[model samples]
Structure formats: C-alpha cells, structure tokens
Target chain A: MESGNLRCGRRLITSETGRGEVVKIEGRISFLGEVNPKEGKLYDGRSIKGKVLIAEGAKGSTVGAYVIYALKYYGNQPLAIIFEEETDPIVVSGCVMAGITHGDMFGKLDLRDGDVVDVWEEDGKLCLGISKTPP
Target chain B: MHLTREEERMLKGEYGEAMRIAMEIVVKVGEVLGADKLVDISHAHASGVSYGTIGEPGLHWLRELSSKGAKARVYSTVNPIGMDLDDPNKIPVGEQFYKKQMEVLQAFKDMGFEISVTCTPYYLRKPKPFERLSWGESSAVAFANSVLGSFTNREGGPLAVASAITGKTYHAGLQVLENRRTTHLIVHPELDDPVEWSALGYLVGEKVGSGIPRYPKPPQDEESMKLMLAASAASGGIALSVLEKVTPRGTYDIGDEERVEIDEKEIEELFRFNDPELIFHGCPHSNLNELKKINEIIKDKVSREFWIATSPKVFDEALREGIIQSLENKGIKVVKGTCSVVTPIERLGYKRIMTTSAKTYFYLNRKGLEVALVRVRDLWRVVT
Candidate 1:
C-alpha cells in the first residue's frame, strides 16, 4: 500500500501490498450518503478511468455488489475500499471470498478525491494506505 | 458480559454436533470485532438463503452446516420465501421467480425456522425495541435500531443466528451505542419537503460514506425521523446510524436547532430519472399511513403491476379492506414480505425500475437495471 499496509493486525505474508506514488483521497468518512457511485447520476462525467474509490459498503443499494462485480468483471473496480464502520459485511466477505482483493481501509485513513493511490496484492492480502501527494 | 453455562457448552459443541462449528464461527466473528459476551437475541432475520453467484464454497459450507440439523435455538426471521409456481396465476407470471422464492424458504424451513412471509415483521409481531432481535433487512435494521431503539446487529446471515443463540455478537459496530456517537456531518441544505428530504438523504449517504452523520438537532417527530432514518439506512447498507440529535445518546450535541440540510441543486440533479416501468416501495416496509397514502395515490395512475410489500399483518389488513384486491384490480400487486428488489427482474416483467427512495434506486442502479427515480411523496404524486 502506498499509504501503509494494514491487514488483520499486520499478520499476513509481507510485501503483499502495492508500491506506487501516493494518492491522497480527500473525502469524508460517511456513515451516510452512499458508496456505490454507479447507482446514481453522481458518477464522474468524464472518466473514472483510473480514480480509486475509498468507501465502506455502499448505502441504499443491494446492487452495490452487482455494480462492483460488473466493474471488476470488466476491470473498472475501485482501487480499494476502506471501511470506518461496518457498512455491509457482505462487501468485504464477498470480495475476499471471491479473491477480488480491495485493499483494506482501516484506522483513520483520511482520503480525499484526486489522491493518487497505488494498490496490489500478495499472499492473500491487499493494501492501500494513503498519503498526500507532493504539492 | 458474562457467558451462561449453556452458552459455554454451545461454544464447546455440547448442544448439537453442528453447534461446535457454528458456535466457533460465531465466536471467531465476535473475537474479530471485539465483542465481550453473548447477548440473547429473541428472533432473527437472515440473508444467506439466496445461493450466491459470488462464493460457491462459502455457499456449500453453509448449506452443509445447515443440512446437519443446525436449528437456531431461538426464534428467527428470514428473508421472504420464494414460491414455486405452476402457472402465472398458479403462482405468478414465471416459475423461476416462484422457485427462487421456494428455494429460499425451503432452506429456512429445513433449518427449523417457521417461515413468515412479510418484510415488516414488527407489524405482524413487533419485537419491542431494545429487545435483542437479529434482523437483516437493511432498512428494517435502521428502523429497529434508530426508530424503535432496539438492540441488534445486522445478523450477517444464518451465522448471526448462531451468534444470537449463543448470545454473542461481535461488539464492533451497531451493537455498541457509544461507538455510535455522531461523527458530525455539517449538512448545508435549502429545502424541507419529503421529496427534497429524500434527495438530501441520498446526497448525505453519498457524501457521508460510512461514518454516522451527526446533526445539530433531531427530526421534529416520527414523520421527519422516518425520513432521516430512511435516508441514513439507504446510504449505509447496514442501516441504523445515529441521527445526532434525536437518538438517545446522540442528541446532546445537537440542540433544538439540529437537523438535516438539503442541497437543492444536488437534489435537483439527483432526482432526475428516465422512463421507469414500475415504482416500488416497502423495502423496509411502509407504516400504515404510508400504505394508505400509496393506496390513495395510485387510485388512478397505477397502470402497470405495482408492488408494495409489507408484513402479513399489514397484508391481512389490506385484504380485509379489499385494498390488496383493489390494487390487484388496478394492476398493483400488494404482496406480503416480498419486495421487488429480491424478485428476479425478469419475473417482475420489467427491465427498468424507478423509485424515490435512495435505497431502492441504488439497488436498481447496481443491478444495471434502467431506473427512473423520484422522491417518496413525489412518487405518490407520480402514481396518482
């Protein structure tokens, strides 16, 4: 994780996260609003071609999984998902159970939009800790 | 926070052979979330009944564990049972819809739960708020926790029942109220109608993400509280986030002036919808007046098959009044316990779904279904 690799109390195969220049996501840790952007017209107008979404579980939509699954199946899934609160256990459970690793968002990782994030996986673990890019 | 001897035995597999594995899974889930002791859950509502296209092994493991006589030693509620149809009237339009309903129900009955088909079990049999209840309806959970002020976590499928039987839930999120203190979302709004409030909620769910939104005040009454809770639940799949001012512990920070702020510009943009085949409601089950309002609103405009799901109790009331039949005569199907979301889209005979509720809209969008959205009261207006 460009930010920091925090997975299950640091007990997984090491070097399992991605290494890249930092991307700081400047967004509120909302226990409201929603996570799945595809469900609303709120999706980016131009292209979310490389932007990584940092959210817990999506709000209001059972299709959260469907949208994520579709995006992943088509290679448009978020860079990673960080959860401050337990949104839907299924979100992480499904991702993990399916081997689709979205790096963990844990322990007060404040993210804002346009924060360049780098992600990857190793030994059944994914990481995406964030840091502010160079001003 | 102490465990009973019976619970301890269940943990160690003394009850049923399956309890050993099931209880262990519960214990592990709790341990991961740092729950202290087991809490008795009177009834539970569950989800894993639908065979997932996501995890086959997890599905298989659940099926096998359930097959081994894994009854939840406590009363439980589950998702709507799918019925097997012989004909569109024999069951409904398609066999697949009915079959899925049947399979889901059969799985529950096989596991020892007396199946009741209604989304609002509270209406059928209201579990007193704060009574330990294990439920899974996203909107229902919020209603239970925030509206009714109950004690429950979103029993994560059947395993949640295992935790309930053993009386142990991972004390991570919803179970712990203090962890529910407001995160203070500064809502900057400009409207206060139901439709506006609904859209504001959608925006809040989007902007707030996963932290509980703390307002400066609470909704004025049950009606306003209802809207706020609906929006909060919709944005947070788990539902039941504390409304800063109205909730028992959350209101202190939110004085009399605390409330939800609406971004009319954002809401105007968000409320836009394309042509929709159907307008659906009752994902969390509508209260009496809401149902009546629906009945009155669609008295004229409900030209297609409309669905408004509720508990059997509500369904019965409608049946007695002939409201259900009246709607049926008008192309609306007022069913019990089943909502349009869970029914196969094909079964509903519509490729596009539309709604005012952010929660419903999100699901439709997620499924790649064409959805036209309007706010709640607006939906009533649109239907009429």
Candidate 2:
C-alpha cells in the first residue's frame, strides 16, 4: 500500500468534506448519459455511493449538473469528486449546488480503486491525504 | 479577481439574494478559470430546461431560484423543455410528466427568460460579429462562435443561468481573443450534401476533442454549417470551428499545425436508409429555408409518421409562410418547444428513429434508441 499527500488545484465546493475509498474512472465522464442518476450508477454498473470518485473530467450535456444533483438526491452521491484534469463548469456547478466536495488534482496519481483518501480544506485551500487500502 | 463596484454590490446582496448567489457563482467560476475580471455579455442562453434530462431535483432547484426572485438581468433565453409547450398533447407523455414539464418551463419563464425553447437562438436573433455571449447549448455555442464570429465559452446550464442573472461571465476561454486561434487543421472533403457535412463534423469532433479545427474551404451555407457544427459539438466538445472565407476575418487565426484529412468514403459510410417508425427533422430547429425545402419536397403527400420539431417562433414564421399548414395537411406533426434528443422517445413508444442530423443520430443512440442516418434530399424517400 502506498500513502502520501496530494495537492489540489482549487476547491470548488467547500460546503462538504469527505474521506472514503476511491472509485477511479480512467477517462472523462459524461454525467448525463454515462450516469444513472436514480441509482447513482455509472454505465458499467458501478455504484459511486460514498466513494471518492476520481475521473479525468466531465463532458457531454450541459444538463449533466442535474445528473450530479440527482446522485445527491437519490442518496448515492460520492464522498468527493477529484478530477485529474481541471474541472469543467458542469461538474463545478453540480458540486456547488449539491454541496459535494470537488477539486482538481495535479497529474495522475499512482492510486487505484479502494484507496482510502481524505479530501478536506486547509486555510481556504483544498487538500488531499491518501492511505492505500484494498477492497 | 477584480469586480466592479456594481458587481461588488450585487455580491454583497445589495441587489437581491438571488443576485448575490448568482454573482457568487460567476465569481467562483471566474476564479477557478483564472479570469482577471467579469465581462458584460449581450445575451445568455440557459440549457437543462428539459424535465426528462434534469429530472426532479433539477425542477426543485429551478423553482427555488425562481422563488428567490432570480430574474434575467440580460436578454436571456432558454433551451427546449421535455415536451411541446404550445401543444402538450403532441408528445406522448403521461399527465404527471406533462405537468412537471410545464412547471419547469414556468420556472424559467418566471425568471424572465424569453422561452426561446431552441438550440438555434441564432435564427431568432443573429449575433453580430464579436458579440459576447454566455450560452449553454453546446451546438449553439459552437455555431455562434464558429459561424457567427461571436465569443462565448460553452457554458454549463447553471453557469449560463448565473451569467443571465448577473449579466456577466468570467472573461476566459473563447471570450479571450488570443485563445481563439488553433493549430489543428482538418482537410475537409468536398461535399454539397448536408448529411455528409454532418458526418464530417462528427468525425472531426471525435478527432479534435475540445480543440478548434480550422478548414481551408468549408461549407459556406448556413444549413450545412449548422448541421456540421451541431454534430461536432455533440460528438466532440468543440465550441469554435474556423472556416476560411465563411467566418468573419480577425475573429480567429490559423497556425501551421497537425493536418487530418477526411475522405469521401468515410463520410459516405455513415449514411444508411432504414425503416424507422419516426422520421424527425429540425434537431437544431429548422430554419425558414429548411422548412421551405421540406414543404417543397412533401408537397401535400406524406406517407409516414413524420414529425418536424422546431421553436414556436420559427413555427409561427413557417405558419405565416403557409409551409406549416402544407406540411400539417400531409400528416406531418410540426411539434414546438421540444425535440427528440431532450424528450424521452423510448417511453413515447418510438424505437427506430431516422434523421439526417448527426447530432440527433448521436444523442438518440446514446439514449439506446435505434437511429438511422440519411441525407436531407433523401428524406423524401422516408417520408413517402
């Protein structure tokens, strides 16, 4: 197991903080079609409930913000959303309205799914602390 | 980020609670994107109005905003909803669905939006060259930037609303003149058919991702450009496409960069004729010329379950020109305020849908519906 401090680009939604296992999507996600908001499930049937979701970024419909909101409404929202690339307007607005923890991390971390990560704010800057854990 | 005294007043809740919240959203987005200041926009178009797309939570948020006295501070417009507003019965949705969709539209209307209910706002009011806008519809964002030589970053639904309320957006992305040029070049095939143009757009979008693609001799006609740009925005996150001799000079620049060539075979391979239950048009809302062409083709003899989805404003114009009645007489349903992409067509009992729009084909297929692509000229075969 690997553990280290991860730097965050900016804190988008500081209303909430989260610490949980990571569910990493290697590519960008189109929350509108790729996500089933009612179930908080991705296209491949993975549940994002309570996990710290890591993705490249978001794409597709501008309505994707609502899909992100639905995840919160259905009680299956991720603990936090960490984008390897910079976050787009859709995901930022979604996390803002949904009160979910969202931030951009620099580069790709040598992290995998089920890695325990803590996403929080320190002195108005977003911070991440990771402790690798297995499923 | 620097805010004007008036902008600071709004942020401090001097304008209103809604205006404060809106200003916060704009400022936050600007800070995230590293903008120097906010730019006053001429227009703002918000998407995510469709009930089927946004669902229950979206409706609640919108209603909440409307209740908080969030009104448009600029010339704001809204995208299509889940059902036809003029004739709710046109779409095959249950009573509850109908009511919810109406409430969604009402929320936006209450906020003083024009309810343009279209992805093609350019048709209603053509943006002048270099006009700054904050628009949500990806296709319209691409069209306005690439075709009309306007400036707008492809905004998300909420960001657009915030811009509308604040009458400003973060001055970054396409709004900045220096970022408008692209080194990526697409050697487009010579094609006259709008369907082929759409296909080219889809292919280019897939290859280009978010980068702008400049063409040497791109299609100049409005219809061709519309289909191509819409398809590109659908498949790829392209907001600006530079075309030589078409786009106004000085809005964008071209650099000697990577070149990708598209062949006739690639474009031709996308076309397929199929027995679709519904033959739909106006994915971006049919312009007067498109309506006139469809009217000339049908000529009072329609043989299939056809639907022409358009904005209410365009429908009124077509009605005045006698094209709407002629198409209606031939049993073609000219639905307004909704389209196949945003509407839940699967629940409406439509399985196989066919259209000439690559945007429609891409989005409908994403929704798990069988979509067939054909040319605009060949639409007659499907209609008959």
Candidate 3:
C-alpha cells in the first residue's frame, strides 16, 4: 500500500490531466440526489470544485449524468474523478458529457482526503502520483 | 475489445463531430463494462428529458448536441418532460420552465426522435423478442428486458442518446445470453391486487439489488405486471427479471439460485391509508383498461382532487370513446404526456399523494410528497 505511484485499470479519458488535493468520499454517490451542483458541494458540505474527487463509484439515479453536467454549467465541477470500483454507466455518461477527467479500478489505492496528487496518463494508462506532503 | 471496420471509422471521426463524440462515449462505456464488441441496435429510447430533473445544464447539453447536427440513426423515442404538453399550465411551473421544456423537446426532435414523451414506449411500438436495443427510463428498460425478452442494459439518459446517434451499443450485461440467467428466486403470497403486486416488486427489488430474480408465479394481467416491473426498476437497478410464465421462454434460465420469500407483513406495511390532497394513478401511464376501470369505479363526482395521467395517444383514444368526458364530468382531470412523478407536482402544493403504483410511491416520496400506497380496489373509497 505504498503511496508513491499507483496505476488504474484503464484510462477512461486522457486528453487532460488534473493536479489537486484529494476529496475522498467513503461510499458510492448518486450524483443527482447527493450533490448540490450550484455550490459544487456534497450533501455533507464537502466542496469538490477543482478538487480530485474520489469515491467507490456511482449508484442510484441515472439522471446523475445531467447533474454532473450541471456542475460544469454552474462552474462548480471537480478537476478529475477516480473510482475505487468499476465505473457505472451513470459516471461514464456524466464524465463523457461533462468532459471531466476520470478513471476507474483503483480498489486498493492508499489515498486519503486532503492528500495532494497528480493524475495523468502514461503509455495510454492512468497514473496517479501521490505527493510527499502530509495532510 | 474488437470493433468492426465501420465502428473503427466512427471512432476515428469519419463521421461528424456529434457522431464521433457519441461513438466515443458508447465505446468507453463498453470497455469499462466488459463489452467485447459493438452490436447494432434496432431502437433507442432516451430519458433525462424532464426539465425539472435535468435543469438548465441538461437543456444546454441537448442544444449543443442538436446544434452539432446529431440525429437519431435508428427509431428513437424520449421520456416524459416536466409539464403536460396538452395543457401546459396544469403542472404549475413558471413561464421560464415552459420555455426551457419546449427547447428540450425541440432538441430531441432535431435529433430525429419521436418526442413521444412517455416512459412506456412499448405502447407506441412493442419490441419483438430478442430485439437489440439501447433504452433509458429504468421502468421501460425493465419491461423491455424482463417482459419482452429483448436485449438491453439499463442505460443512462445521455448514453442512450449516444446510442441513438450511433445506432450501436456495446455487447455486455443483459444483452449476452448467459448474463440473463437468474441468480435468485422470489417467492410471494397469492395476491390479486395491483397495489400488492407493486409492494412485492418493491420488496424484491430492495432485497435483491441488481441481481436477476425469477418469479415462479407472477400476476397474469398486464397492468399488474407493469406495476411490478416499474416498481422494481424504481426501487432498485433491476434491468431484467425472469418471470416464469410471462417472460418469453428460453430467454432466461435458472441456475443454482438463492431463494428469497416475501413476508406478508412487509407488503402490509407498504400500504398506507393516510388521506392525501391529490390522488394520482398511472406512473407508467395508464392503458385503456385502466382508464375504463377508473371510469366504472368513480360513478359519483370525486369528493377530492383526482387526476389520471396517460400517454397522448391513449388520451386521444379515450377522448374518442367519451371516457375523457365521463371522467371529466366526475371532476377527474385526465393529464396527457406527463405524470405526477416526472412533472413538478410537489411545487403544485400538494402535501401528500395517494397512488397505486409502487413506482409512483417511491418517486413521489423522493419528491418530498408524503406518498401512500393504496390498493386499486380501494381507490374509489379513497377518492370519495
């Protein structure tokens, strides 16, 4: 469980890279009901705007794709998203439509909230380089 | 993953920008979901049309796609919007909402979609057995996969739109024959009531999550089956279920499956008798039989507010048969092209809603309305 470098199963999107503090959510998110797009906050008041948002994966409403699009519309969107499990159709459609940097299959990554990381693509695969700074 | 020469051309942007983007989305989703290749789909149905649910951002996205010349390559349909198009003011949204809703419809129409504005597209054109499809609207997806024996995953709204533009979807999930097998068995008590069927579906869906459940003996009537299927999709992510007699044989098979029995008590707990300010039926939109049944029950004028929602085509037939006038004479408002669950019914100032469909029960409750699941037989008593 080293934190230096980790690889994902696939790089869903590789056109852009994201470098920001991690915002770790413990469970799956149903973007429609759990997120407040206008403020870019979760129901618990954690702001994902410009942060590297990570979660188990998506669940609940498929309308979540539109909610994610709304996040971009309101200028309250995450810089990137990472899923610990295989991404669901809701997340795939949302990230595709919203042009968000996302990857899946990092079920064993040793990461935490407030940690800094650089998410980029190398060899057509997703790479997460964890920063040395302690949170 | 394997791709045909045509699919490779699509991914390589041989098509327009809209088609390219749509193909990319579908391909990426397929890769993640373990799809080996893309398959041609006969039809596609897109959801997320409701302005209330999707908001301005969704409208903007639709406009962008349409402006880029994205069109449906196959026969396509859409889900319900936020308002009743036949009577715009009935749902009680602002002028801004009406304008935005129209723009949403125009975008879909521009994409060559039928703009049917219904979750029950099976009524518009029933899918044949083993037809490949990419459809949104969870309830409709359930009906297509579980009841009609068609092949489709429960696709998200945007993904379905993408599939419509590309005329293809990744071969995965329920589309594969082996994936259609039942992993669990659902046992329930004998119940003739539609509400009881709804409650059973909710219970089973909540218990089974996304796993396919086989019902040994399901209700024979179409309305009751519709209620059950819709309820399951609403409560859980059940795309396909195996109904012993109802589901087309050979479409699904049972393996070593876990058995889950419905407690009669749980079904009873789902039923509530609280007086609601408005009573609504037809979450999936009422069929002709449902309309006639409602017409026969409420002989006297309604003592409280009552509304029946149906598709535009059904409404037209009901109008021709004088069912509309008969229900209207009894103070029942027959809403078309929209239902309470999709529209902004909560904003109309109703504190509680009484419905017979578990699908309606789940959605109306989510809308912050106090929803009560009442038996269909007792609907007349509640209305009075």
Candidate 4:
C-alpha cells in the first residue's frame, strides 16, 4: 500500500523489492542460500568465502532424504542469505537441510552486488536506501 | 460480498461449529487476496504436516487456526512430507522423528484425507485436465493452472487443505476465470534438451513471478513439466501459464486471452555455466514410472561416486526392487529427502557435486553448492 522513492535493485538484501526488510543477516559459510531474485540462479554462482552476500528465500531440508547432504558437507559452503520475504522457503529449507543458522532479523545491507547500500531499522520496520549498485 | 443462503447460515454458525470455523478461515484468506465471493472447488491439495519453519511459531498455529484433522470431503490431495516417521526402510531416519510426524499426519488422515505423498497428484490420480481443482504444490499450482488447465489459486500449505475440507475457498483470484487469464505472450523453447529446460523455466518464472504465462506447448511429457514447474517455483513464487491448446480447457475450456513478452536472459541463468555439485530430478517428486526409466538409464555407469536424488517413496520402491541397492553396491547414492542445493556437503567436508535437473542447477549455485555439473537425463543413460 505504501512505498518510498526507491531505486530497486535486483537482489534480496535490499528493501526496494518485495522482501526489502533486512530481517536477518548471516556471514560466510551460508548454505541454503536464499533463492536470489537478481542472480536468478537458485545458487547465485558466487564465491561467498568472504564476500558480503545477499539471497532470496531458503532452499530444501530434511535429514536423510539423500539429494545433496554429502555434497554440502564436503563442499564447505559458508555464506548467509538476506530475508526478502517472511520465510523464503528455499533459504529456510536449505538452512534446515544444511544445519546452518539462517538469519532473518539480523543484518543490514542495501545490496545490488556492488551498490554501497544504506540499510537501517526505523522503529520496528527495516528500511534500505541504496546510493549505488553494479550495472 | 453476497453470501449464498448456505454460506449465510454457516457464517451465522448455524452450520456445525466445525464448518463455521472453517468458513471463517476461508473468509480471511478471501479478504486478504481481495476476492469478491467464494466458490466451490471439487478438489484440493496441501503442504501436509511436516516440521514447519523455525520462523513461524511452528505450523501448530496454522493447525490450530483450521480444523487440522478435519476430514476433507472434497476430492483433495497433498504434497510430500518430511521423510517417513515409522518406516523400517534400510536408510530409515530416527524413530522419534518418525513417530512425531506420524502423529501429525494421522490427525489429518483422521480428518478424512487420503495419504498419497506425491507432488504431482494430478499424474498419480488423474484429474480431468481442465477441471478446477485446489492444489498447494507451487510447482503443481503453476502446472495445474497453466498445463493442466485445472483451476487453482496457488493456495498456500494449510489454506489449500482448509479449502478442500470445507469444500469452499475464499474465492480470490482463482475464483473467476477472468483474473485467472494468462498475460505472457509467447514462450519459445530455447533449450532442446531437458538440461536447458531448467534454466528456461527459471528464466520464465523469474520474469513472471506470481503472474500468468501462456506458452507454445509444454513438452508433451511428465519429465519436461517437472523441470519447468520446479524452475517456475524457484524463479518467483507461483505462475499459472496459459498452456495454449495443451491446457485442459484450451479454446473449449479457456476464456479470452492476452499476451506479454519475456526476456531471453531470464531463461538462460538456470543453465548458467557453473561447477556442478550434483544432478537432481523429480522437482515435484519423481513418480515410480519416471524413476524406473531413470534407473534403467543409469545401471551401468562408470562413475563410482555420484549422487542421484528422488523421493523416499521412490527410493524405497527402487530398493525393494533391487534397483537402487545394486547401484549402491556400485557406489551410487540413490537417496531421498535432501536436495543437492541445500545439503551441507561442506559440513561432511567433501567438495564438488554434479547433477542434472534445472531446479537443482539453479538452487545449488545460489547457495554456493560446490562441484561439477552434468545433464540429468545423461545419468539416466547409465541405467539405460
């Protein structure tokens, strides 16, 4: 019903889009990466080793279902996803599956890949103001 | 909002307390989506009971809101749950998890639900393609709306069940045949093989999130539908593409239609060149026939170490038939429950995975899934 003068970026960590509130933030070793709206890949094809990251929703989980647990255990994926929606099923499902702490009310970043994002909390609401981003 | 005489009675609580409660929840959903009136859908589908997210106060809140175990009189269906609780299978999960889940599912079954645990219920139990049926599988929702021409609103996990039980839904966007119309103009198949189908679906879905799409004709097969539907769910939330002549209703079943254009780049990312970690199949959960074909294609693969994924039900069936066990003896993992994109492969400390399945290809890359990549059907050649 209400939106501000926003420069919408194609990433999950910014508030200019559907799940703009930076609810939770994670660091390197993030798995079950949120399905990024920008990158379009469910995996986003990024090197999260030490990069400040962003993501959409969660992926998949369940202990013994047998699709990819062994692969992740050996792969060493350590990155975090930004909560764009209430509970992005992809990121949540992935975190649950990977046994990682997927955050929702934790970090701040007005992301657009290379954008110098201005994210903050206003009262109880989260807001993002982007100053720059990658083309 | 004019209510039918029966609807008015239910609103006044003249109907049994249970029906009244169910209607209340339906009404809320209707209001949220800005529906004018409620309509009757003959069939429905739901997410079913499983470990809900750590986010929501668990699914118990949803359970409490509606009659969880209430019998769904409508010809209803459901998605797969979190692994079997009481199974004595070879790779059975913990008994506690099993017992706990069985209790949850039993409540629903007690309420008059059937326990078929597949995603594309339309396949296992054929619904006349275009007939309006309520379903919750995101993949199935789009598939139903677009491909099958069956009517649905992409109803969420619990709401889908509520709609089934009460025999009525809030009648939002799914109620009328007008807003239910497709806007996407033409979808040209960019990928000739199944591998490209994943990215193609992702591309289309991302462009038309929560929007309607009309396409040339879906791949006239189940595997193709699965690949496209999975990416559709991944790219956005849900999309009900107007499946042209193939749609259940088509000209005979469709209303007036319009067209919207899509970006080619959107469809390409799914096959975006990335190191592979694993090959995935059965986005809507592979059914038996599909698995049988996949098993046949992989029987003599030289890859001592690789991962193949499907539902536990299929895996168990494959195991009982000695298909998977033989492959396991050959060091292949025909596993279930976990997807390559979400598995904590780094935790187990292995590196790299290779898989085919556009759904997996897109998802794994986002979470930084490690490894190599291969086309899904190529692995099928192994058993072939």
Return the top candidate by TM-score.
3
The candidate that achieves the highest lDDT relative to the unseen native structure: 3
How would the candidate models be sorted by lDDT, starting from the highest?
3, 2, 1, 4
Where is model 1 chain B poorest over a 10-residue stretch in terms of lDDT?
B82-91
Across residues B304-338, which tens digit of lDDT does each residue of candidate 2 receive? Answer: 88988889898899899888888888899999978
lDDT by residue for model 3 (B1-384), tens: 899998999888888889888998899889888899999999999988888888889989988989999999999999888888767777678899899899999999999999798889999999988999999988899898888998888898899999999999999988899988898899888998987998999998899988898998988888888899899988887888888888998777787789999989999998887788999898889988999999998889999898888888888899999999999999988888888877888778899888888998888787777888888889889998
Please give the lDDT score at residue A6 for candidate 3: 64
DockQ of each model against the real complex? 0.07, 0.59, 0.78, 0.03
Q: Write the per-residue lDDT of candidate 1 for residues B99-207, one digit (tens) a residue.
A: 4445555656666765665545565566664576767665556667765667666555545545534444555566665654555455655455554555565667676
Candidate 4's C-alpha runs over 4 A off are A1-135, B14-17, B52-69, B84-96, B187-190, B249-278, B301-353, B362-373, B380-384
Off by over 4 Å in 3: A1-9, A132-135
C-alpha lDDT of all candidate models, in order = 0.53, 0.85, 0.87, 0.52
- lDDT over C-alpha atoms for residue A102 of model 1: 46
**TM-score, structure 4 vs. true:** 0.63
True contacts kept of 2: 0.65
Report how large a share of the reference interface contacts model 3 reproduces: 0.79
| Clash count for each candidate, listed in order shown | 48, 0, 0, 87
Task: Supply candidate 1's per-residue lDDT for B16.
Answer: 74
TM-score of 1: 0.67
